[model samples]
Target: MPINADYKYIAAEIEFQKAETGAQKMKALRNMLSTAPTHKGAERLRADIKRRIAQLKDEIVKTKKQGKGRSFAIKREGAAQIVFIGLPNSGKSTLLSKLSSKKIKVADYEFTTTKPEVASIKFENIWLQAIEVPAVHEGYAEHKQGRQFLAIVRSADFVVVVVKEFRDIAKIQAELKKANILLRKTKEMIRFEQHMPHMVITWKDFNKKNLVRELWKAQHKIRVQTRAGHKIAPKPIVLQEGATVETVAKTIHKDMIRKFRFAKVRGPSAAFKDQQVGLEHVLKDTDIVEVFMK
Candidate 1:
């Protein structure tokens, strides 16, 4: 059916199309449908729009019946947010109970975790936040609140999943993939090329055990120096290892990592003074690095 071409209505259409989740998109459509002009000329078009809205509402209700749970919207906390996601009875809650003192409900039945819970995992100087998301069952996979739960996972800095021997990680991966979340990866970083940028680029091959250290180091501050031997009083830009030439980027934007045509490094990770490196070179802690755009 044809929607009104008014500027305000067009904006609403854009919002609906751009919405990432089904619930969010449905809400957007309803809001747009409300602005329909109440003239006889627009009656049929408006009626069609209302019918579509009703169908969306029905779909949402049917999905909720499959997996009944309250909508969840948890604010991210700590240095990094990692979560446990798996099939029902996959031990997500049990794993969280063992990791921290937080008392979580643990049960042998599927969908025991009625809600998401967070716990802290202390690693030396840093504390990593771990969350246990309620189990997902094939039957309840389309529940309205499932989008909200998956939203939490999508915003997470890392993912730590629990699974049984028979649990299909592939299926789990497919479900989470719909949320634009990654199950496995080795690298995450920001790329800089003078004026233009390629947005925040991530690489492959990440391990979960060292994530605490990896997250800490990748999100910490870096002390940067210029190519002219001019000390700019480094402000600590956080970046990960093996940044090679342009390694001093930040994930949190606490500081800026200048990208030059070439960079020089002088530290234990380097073989000699002012050793030139590429963006693929790994960096070491407390290393002295210099950048040049000219």
Candidate 2:
């Protein structure tokens, strides 16, 4: 499948958060804002990213003030860090309350959340951490406040943009664009092929005629290269239908890709088969992957 530009931004942000320098962090933030969807749904994300950038700047200042010998970095924890971004009164507190065990201040007004908050959510056997940041206005990043917020945005694993049903979507989009975020629409694709119930295989062709046969070809393929441009080959792993990038990484190698860098989609998005793409690219059934390192 062809990877959309929006997905690329998300993938870049995830990779940037793992970086240790202010310059790389800012570059990743720029990519995220440049590729995020410019819609009401993306408004929250715009705010969150802006806030994170500001926070990052503040960290740099603090580090400089403390002297260059001190390292300024955020220690990552949990399998995933989901960041909730939205405007004031966008139901972020409400949603967080329902999703995790953390107790956050919930109210009916704006700016209720003045800082970022973290919580733990357990899904099946996996425990994920969620981060909630302060609400931001349009064009916030152009100012000192926005620069301070960027610190938090650059550290999150994934972003959840929240918006109300009846809101000024255009205005929200304008704000997101000002922050350099691009918002795009996405649709789900489903594929059915006759293959082993659970196994991984790589094929040169994924045309409709050979779809059934591709399903049965199962042999572990080692990810020789990563999407983030890493050289080392990870462990051989199997790809299952509907498996998420994170799950795929676990099977490949331990500590290979800290989080999903980005995913390249192959087989069945367009007329071309074996299409390559970035991490933000959502995977369809029977998609071949070369997992990237973070």
Candidate 3:
């Protein structure tokens, strides 16, 4: 198809090129398409612009559905939510099935998995959830589903960039960067600093140890088992080391602190076996605590 010679369309094309986010580029494209002359030269441009707009709308809808707490079901509830992203047929499905018990469809073809699939994986004692999303490819960002898929990626606690070959890595990485979901380390990756608060990278590689040791430094976690039940919840509750029993109660439930009386403890944080401690007692990792309201 021949290109449009209109200057207004040219300006819109420039705006689209300068746009950072997919949404922005899409909007620019729409504006440019409308101003473009309906000459034979701009025939393909109109179709391309319409397709781009539709894709952008779809992406916006997908992201909103996930964010609005609707059918997306990709919410973060466990210790952390890890998402796997890569080009189609890049072994993401295989890796997800290997890491998690959840059964997700995998095929040798492209675009087998279209929606986000959730599964739980164990990291030592910690339980981290994994989400597998649609495969991304060239012009994927131009697809509405592609943008929608990125919305899902944004909510992840950590990101796994799947790659079958080495060269393909750069393409996915650059795409992620444009969406503000950086894969590279920023200031917040630092654990010892304790002062840098604004770390914005959305995706990270999975650690072999199973445990996301990086998440630990971000939020010190401990398993608080109910003495009555003799075990902690599926995932450990996140808290600071100095946080007390009352603090944990508040975390588990808002009314827990008010209904709380005294708690018994066993494990590293306690001084004695089944020690009767007050609400202010500090907790430690793997601490077994029983709260009594009655």
Best by lDDT: 3
Candidate lDDT (C-alpha), each:
0.57, 0.51, 0.65
Instruction: Give, for candidate 2, the lowest lDDT window spanning 10 residues.
Output: 188-197
By TM-score, is 1 or 3 better? 3
- List TM-score per model, in order: 0.45, 0.41, 0.56
RMSD of each: 16.7, 19.1, 21.3
Ranking by lDDT: 3, 1, 2
User: Native-vs-model 3 lDDT?
Assistant: 0.65
Q: Model 3, 218-250: lDDT tens per residue?
A: 444565555444444443454556878887666
Task: Output the better candidate (1/3) by lDDT.
Answer: 3
lDDT of model number 2 = 0.51
lDDT of 1 by residue, 1-294 (tens): 122234344445445654555687787778677865667767875787688789888988898789855457655444456767778776667666755667899877777887788788765534567787877666334666777887776666656555664235667766756655444532443211121111111112233355445545544433332222444323233234444444342321112244335667887778998888765667775566655442
lDDT of each residue in 99-126, candidate 2, tens digit only = 6777899987788987677777654333
lDDT of 1: 0.57
Q: List residue ranges in candidate 1 displaced over 4 A.
A: 1-71, 139-141, 177-238, 242-282, 285-294
